[model samples]
Structures are given as structure tokens and as C-alpha cells.
Target: MPKFFNTAGPCQSDIHYTLPTGDRLPQLEKLIAQRNYFVIHAPRQTGKTTAMLTLAQELTASGAYTAVLLSLEVGAVFPHDPGAAERAILDEWKQSIKFRLPENLYPPEWPDTNAGSMIGTLLSNWAKKASRPLVVFLDEIEALSDETLISVLRQLRSGYPNRPQGFPHSLALIGMRDVRDYKIAGGGSQRLNSSSPFNIKVESLTLQNFSLADVKNLYKQHTEATGQIFTPEAIERAFYLTDGQPWLVNAIARQATEVLAPDVATPITVDLINQAKEILIQRQDTHLDSLAERLREDRVKAVMQPILAGQDLPNVPNDDIQYLVDLGLCKIDNGQGLEIANPIYQEVLPRVLSYTTNASMGRIESRWLSDKGELMPMELLEAFLGFWKQHGEPLFKSTPYPEIAPHIVLMAFLHRVVNGGGTIEREYAIGSGRMDICLHYGKVILAMELKVWREGKRDPLDEGLQQLDKYLSGLNLDTGWLVIFDRRPDLLPLSDRTTTEIATSPAGRSIIVIRG
Candidate 1:
């Protein structure tokens, strides 16, 4: 059977096109030899499980260590009951060992124990009986929180010193987050600082998304297997859209191969890759949907809200930033500052925020589209003016985040204009203090910049004109619009405030300045 790109669970060599897992973690053997307890963390679906599983299998087959990979997810169900959670985890471990290990390597039976000490006791017994030194990888360690998490970490900490005889020679806690950010929720509400409990860990390593080379190699496997060539542009586009996010990389190729162009002889192109990307975002598949769901989290909002609004950075803590980075929502861009992790996320975030508003915008007539389906910027502007005078306040109130309310409402209105035949691309980041949008329909391209007039700040018209000038230069468009939303408390009603006029940019380009 021909292999396909895999999005769910671990990738199987016989069924999926996968990069070499062992190569991604070259430090595993050294870590095992040194008897280190460590943390392996990454955003979801980044091949952590596949890497650990393969490493465990390779270690066992090498006849040097009896390595096992088991999950702690079951324990999450009994968060408040440490004993019950421990019991569930031990049972899971026993079953996993029974299936994966040879008869001679099976663990000795776990002693019946209360929840608090169950895991420590089980590991101690297993290590005592194992023919060789034992190595264990505990996947989904983040799922077990509160008392269960505390109990499990403490037990592992307690058993750290007695290795190769009383406890496993090496241990790994694998999950979506690094250990530093763990806070025992519910009754135990303190942060799990690295100084105690599982301080035995030597390092907190993270799995990186596929590099550009990794992506090309992965797609090259498909070409080798089935002779369906992925164009160099297609491969590059896949990397740019996904930033090497594992699920997205595979999902794009899978969509292109299996749905968009099933004929193996036809080479996949960048256009088809873009089509696949649009489908993935529109479908809101489980991976992207779950990531969108994280937008509702307070930590996520603290970082994301400002980026969406193009406002200055908020006073968010370092841990919050690290948490979002671990989740793959945003990353620190060199020395500049925090930004959405990639271009695709930059597109998806605002769209997700405006989804409901876009749906509700059906009452607004699509007046901007010409009879020939061309987009008229001035017509769109007039429609927005009318809509803002009538329904903008209510829509603004309905927005989830106050910081980005103006941006979201405008996006929702624009989405109506671009829904069927046009495309709107957005670029906003913290410290930019402006959101830039480019609307494309047929050959007509419109560039727009959105800013806000706060109570004490000067009207942003001059700065906006200069910014729009550079933006238009980049897009090679000689004309654009600059919109400054008046958000001051003393401002007049929307009906009186909404107006547009012409201005010239520093680069001498024509710019339409709108104040509302």
C-alpha cells in the first residue's frame, strides 16, 4: 500500500511519510547513559510521541536498556484523587510493558498501594526485577495535575537517587509544556517551581517543528514512493504557511495529494498548496480548532490581544510568554519582540475572532463588488461608513477582547466584501500601533491601514499616512486608505464622527484618510 501523510498519533513507517525520529533527538542515548531524569516538551502533534516510542524500541532492541514509553493521560481523570490516578497509571504501565517487552523483561507485579506512593513503589519493584537497567518515558505528564501531579512528581523525586537497582536508571516526563510553568490547579494552586519535587531533571528539552530541509525531505519521500512530484515552490509554500508545524505540513500535502490532485502524475504546485491551506483553515480541523480554542485562555489573550490590535506590549509575565511559546501560538522574533508563530497563524487569529461577526454581517449589502466582480475601494468605504453609523457600536460591544474590538469589527465588515471572490491579507504586531490590510479582488488591489485615537494620544493621521506610504510601496500600489478610529470617551456619536478625506503620503502616494 502507498504511504500517506499522517496527522493523528504516531507516524508508522509502513503507512506514513516520516522524517527520521532518532535524528531529531540525538541526545537521548547520552542522557540514558548518564542516568538523567529530564523533561521533553513541545506543542501538540510535533512528533514527540513518535520520537520517544521509536527511541524506546531502538533501546530495547539494542540489548543495553529495557526502555518503555507509557502515558499518564488516564490519571488526569482522577485529578483530585492521587491514589486513584496512581492506580490507573500503574495499570496502564503494566499493560504497556506486557505488550511491548519480551516475557523475560516484563515488570514484577506492582504492590497494592495507596495513591500517593503508588508510582514510586511500582518503579522500585520493576527496577529491582529487571534483567537490565530500566529507562522509562512518561508521556502526557501535563495531563496529571493538582494532587495527582504533585504526588507523581514527588514519588519520582523520591526515587531519583536509587537508580539501576531501586529505581529506573533514567526517566523522562513528556508533555505539551516544560516543567517550569506547571501550576497544580484545584486545591493545590501553587506554581511547581523547578527548585523542588522533580528537580532531579537535568534538562527540559523541546522538539522543534520540521525545518525547511526536513519538510523537503518529508515530501521527497512521497515523490519516491509514488512518483507524485511536489514542486519546489509547493514545498517552500508549505513551509512558509505552516512554519514546519508537523500536523499542518502533513495535512497540506495530504489534502493536495488525496483531494486536490489525486492524479499522481500531475506535479503539485504552490496554487494547489494554497487551496489546501484555505480548506484546512475553513474546515477548522481538530488541530487548528484546538489551537483556536486556546485563544480564549487568559494567558493566550494577554499576548495575542495586543498583537491583534497592533498596540504596545502589555505587562505580561515571562512565564505567560513561555507558556504560549510552548503551545506554539507565538514566538519571540529575534530581538524585535513577540509575534504570532507564523504567517498562517497571523491570518487565522483575526478570522477566528471575527467569525461570528462575519456570519452576522449578512444584512449589509455587498455594494463594493462591481457587476463584473471587481472590488471598488471607495464603494467598500461608503458601505463601511453606512454600516458604522448604524451597527458599529453594537458589534464593537459584542467583541470578545476590548483591545482589538475596532480591528475585529472592521475585519468582520471586510470579510463580507471579500467573502466570495476577494482575499484580505493582514499584518499586525505588537509595537506597530497599526493594523495593515491588503484587499485583493481580480486585478484591483486595495491597501488599508487601521489605527486608533485614544484619549491622550495625538490624532494618528500623520503617522498613519507615512506608514501607509511604506506599505503601499511594498505592495507596489500607488493608492491606499488610512483609517483612524476615534476611541476617546469625549468623542461624538459614530454618525457624526465617521468621515473620509484625501491625503498624500511621504512617498507622494495618494491615500484616503478616514476618521471614525
Candidate 2:
């Protein structure tokens, strides 16, 4: 039986495996033949190392080239000292080859050299001895110092002409960021020439999570191995919670098969996936830790804040957006907007950001009175506005996440309304304008979009109308509310602001407009 769940690096012959599902494999295979220097990057735990190792084996087995997967991550542990970095890498190279290759083929001893020049020397020596074209897969390349990176790139450039004979024919640098975007501190700003050291990269590839079909294939692997069947509904539920992220996909299936439904006769259902998701989130594993770490950066916040506020983001540079996308924190939505990359991220980001504020917000979770047990949308808005009027100035002065205060207040209000009866689903990112809050009561859904009104703006009515229209359309709801917060005190006459119910949006969908 094949070992199906692999969390470490790529799966070996004895371990379980899932066939590559995304766009990366074909691209890597093409690069292997073309002898390109390129990058493979994605969120942590997305199986990058595993995929590269697997690809290397495939290339070697074909007898067309000699492939080796080398890790530079150990160099990172030594800081920027090139000498130490070189020694560590040489040590790792020896160990990796010893473990992966036949004993007779392993190098007996590595040549001594300064760290800055060791990599180039090592590669040149290895290439001289090998008969076939050498393909080097350098994993965790980002962990090396900027100077080391520049040196490495230059060495590759200096040795390219010797490829297919005297040097590695194909080189792949794998890490969290693309090779071009990597800003190696202290390294001279020499633009990398595609034609030189590692030119002719067929493409830069990112490993994506499993698709719904991929998710089913994963579960099918377990069933084939253990004879445990997962109900179709359970599969759908797993997709809904994990959005087909590779780690989460494997995790959910593993939990269900091993813990939730170990017996083949027992049916794995939707509830089991949901239960597994909750368990995973609460555990806050390394996957979650890596994602949360990105949130602390100003760049990430700048992009995510507007999404939480439900406002349109001003045009940001393509490079900035692409950087975040590469980090797996956000994605371009249908080429129209940006959205959190996955359900788990969508669920956890806000909670992680609101951990401190949610406590105070929780205080008002059930403060309002609604006899029908429904959130009185207009009433809740008015109550929040009234509080904002009296305490807004001071609260803004003290709030840590002030950029998202209005949204937080709204969440606090909703938390009060749905305290005992319903749940709120929030979607917001720093730069993605517009926050989506879905309040659910059993089967009924109440959706609201929150926006911030800038000074001198014409009430933001046109923009608000357009956003509400899109929100309602997406939810397939005929009517919903647009709550606009006027940040400027000059426009504030608290009592005169009105809440009007409109029949049709200027764009033509019926929406309720509530201004405060």
C-alpha cells in the first residue's frame, strides 16, 4: 500500500503520493529539458519541495539527464557569513546525495573553498565528473543572504556556457518569492539578464491547491488504500471549508479516515469535514502561523484594509498586487477584484486581527433588542452611528486597527444581534475595497456591504449604489443594505442623516441605502 499523506518534502517510492494537479508540473518538465534557470514559489507547506524532488526523479529515470535536489535552507541558519553558508551547503549536498543516490555514485569528499565562491566551484567540479546533463533543484533558495544570492546568480551566469557539458544544464530556485521579485539586501542592483546565468526560463510556476476534482482524487486514494468511502456530500463540504488548499485537503481527509470514520462501512459526511476544519483552525498549526506572519507587514495591511471596509481600493502598482498574490494571501478575483485566497484564510485573518478588539466588541454582541429575533438592520446602524458620534473621536485615537474600526463596530453590532441565534461570515482584505458580511439565521441570509466616505466625496452614493448592486447580485438577493460611514465631521448632522429604502439601484438592482 502506498503511503498517501506526505507533509514533509516530496513523497518517495515507498510513501503515498498525489499526482501533480496544477500548472507547475508541465512547466517544470519543460524547463528540465530546456535547461532553464527559474523559480518555484508558493505559500509555505504547499508541497513545493516534494513536487521538485518528484520531478527530479522522473527526469533521471528517463535517462535524459542527471537530476539532484539540493537545499540551501541550511545557509540561512548561519546568517550572511558566506564561509559558513558554503560549508553548510556543502555538508547538505553531501548528505542529500548520499541518501538519494547509490553509494558508489556519492562524492567521497568536497573541495574546500571560501563560502562566496564555494557554490560555483562545487557545481563546476560536479559537472566535470558527471556524464549526463546535470539538473540542479535548489530548494529554499530564499533563505540565503542577499550577497550569497547575488553570488549564486552570478556564478550560474558565469557558468551557463558550459551547460550540457561542464555545468548544470537546468537550475531551479524554490522559495516563497519569485526570483525576479526577490530583494536581496546589500546585493548590487544589477538586473538579472534572462539570457545569461539562468536565462530561457520557460515560465515561473506556482503550486496551487487542489481543485474540487483534485480533492476527490485525494479521498479516492485513501479509499483505494483503506477501503473507506467518503460520501459525495462530505467531499463538497471539504471543498467548501478548505477551498481545495493542498495541506487542508490532506488534513481533512486524513482526519476523516483515521479519526472521524475509520471503518469502511461508516459514511463520512459533510459534518465531519466541518468538524475537522474547526479542529484544524483551533490548533493553529504551522500553516496558519505562516499566514498570520504575513499579516503583520504594512504592505499586506495596505492591501487588506480596504477589502475589510468594503470600499474600492485605489489603483496599486501591479508589482505590489502580484507580490501579495505570490504570498498566497490574496488573489485576483475573475480579473475584476481581489479576494482572500481561500476559505480558511478568509475565516482566520479577521479573527486573528480582531482577537483584541473582538473582546470589547463582544460586549455589545447581544445588547440590542429585537422582538422578532432578527437583526434590525437600520436600527443597528443607527445605534452604532450614535455610539460613533459620542465616542468615535476617542475610540479612533486609541484603536490599534483604526483603519478597520467602522467595520469592527459593525461586526460588534452584528455580534450583539446574532449573539445567541445566528452567525456572521466576514470577508475583508486591506487593499480589496469592500467588506462582505453574511449574517446567517438557520437558512435565511442577510448580507451587508460597508464603505467609508471620503472627504469632499459626493456622498459616495454612486459608488455605494454600484457596490451594493454587485453584492446583491453575487448573493442572488433582490435587496440588501449599503451602510456608508462619513469619516468627515463636516458632513455630520447626526439627526438629519436619513435611511431610505430604494426600489432599484442606479445600475438597476433594488437595494436599501442606509447613510450615517
In order, the Cα lDDT scores of the candidates are 0.87, 0.69
Off by over 4 Å in 2: 1-17, 20-24, 62-64, 186-202, 240-243, 258-263, 281-283, 359-401, 412-422, 427-433, 441-446, 460-482, 490-516
- For every model in order, what is the number of clashing pairs? 1, 20
- In the range 172-261, model 2's lDDT, one tens digit per residue, is 888887766654565523323222434545567788877788778878877787677789999988887777777878777777766777
TM-score of 1: 0.96
Candidate 1, 271-340: lDDT as tens digits: 9998888788678788888889989887788888988888887788888889889999988879768889
Best by lDDT: 1
How well does each candidate superpose onto the true structure, as a TM-score? 0.96, 0.80
What C-alpha lDDT, on a 0 to 100 scale, does residue 513 get in candidate 1? 87
Candidate 1, residue 242: how far the Cα is off, in Å: 1.4
Error of 1 at 203 (Å): 0.4
Candidate 1 off by > 4 Å? 187-190
Best by TM-score: 1
